[model samples]
Target: MDLGKSQRVTRSEIDHILTNRRWSLFDVSVLPSFDTGSDHRLIRASISLNKKNFERDTHRPAPHKIPTFKSADLEPAIESNTWTLFEDLTEDYDHLVGAPLKCADASRHSQPTTIPTLNDRAFAFLEKRKAVKLDPNAKHLEKVITG
Candidate 1:
């Protein structure tokens, strides 16, 4: 069919569009041309359902649950005044979130690497990185560090 004509497109069509393919949608005119010579037609399709389903299928994270450790779970050891157990458990949690850089010999590495720690500051830094791009001239870094 002609490029100007409209048709009911599917998720596959939208995908094609996203992948840089041309999409032909039906014209919005109340009356469609009966002449076959014309290259366009008045087509109707529901984007709401397609958009909603696409978002529902692709928007969220993969189905997975992270393990959790509660401080109260260590109450027995704490009651026994076993600080060692507490420290060990704390270290385990740290390792679970991120690998130990010292163990990785970070100083000996040629490339600079950032170890994300489970803390408010680390989270805020990540948020800033996502929201802003780093400038090569260091203008953005200067504003951030000084502010």
Candidate 2:
């Protein structure tokens, strides 16, 4: 690895490639001819990433509306009391988020279906778009999408 000796630089073998054990390595070589205005030569490696991350779903997620902060009602509530207000808020929040998630048992036969999600609405819009694209009838596109 006498890389930089031709350019009057000190000869050193400091350049090395750190790789994962899961990846399959084919070759690792130094390209000494390709100068990059530096003493160190270009270290090249050919390897295949054998990661499970590559097998994941690559589909774009459906967009949904995010709830904005409502500070008008909450402003005066903070002034009344801190501890009691927080406790009441926590109770209300729990009832809002935790009600539909109750587990099934002997008394409860099965869990209730969740409220219609924004994801479903977005997918419906996507289906309408696909329908409009496939069907060439411009005049009846609205009818096709809706019906």
Question: In terms of lDDT, which candidate is strongest?
Answer: 2
Least accurate 10 contiguous residues by lDDT in model 1? 12-21
Kindly list the per-residue Cα lDDT of model 1 for residues 1-147, writing each as its tens digit. 433346543322111212221232333232254643353443444323355555666676544543333445344433543223235877867654443233333223243244334689877876666555554555766657634
Worst 10 residues of 2 by lDDT: 100-109
lDDT of 1 at 93: 75
Best by TM-score: 2
Clash tally for model 2: 0
lDDT of each: 0.43, 0.55
Error (Å) of candidate 1 at residue 58 is 0.4
TM-score of each candidate structure, all chains considered together: 0.19, 0.25
Taking the tens digit of each residue's C-alpha lDDT, what string does model 2 give over 112-145? Answer: 3444557878888878877776676756747665
127: Cα error in model 1, Å: 11
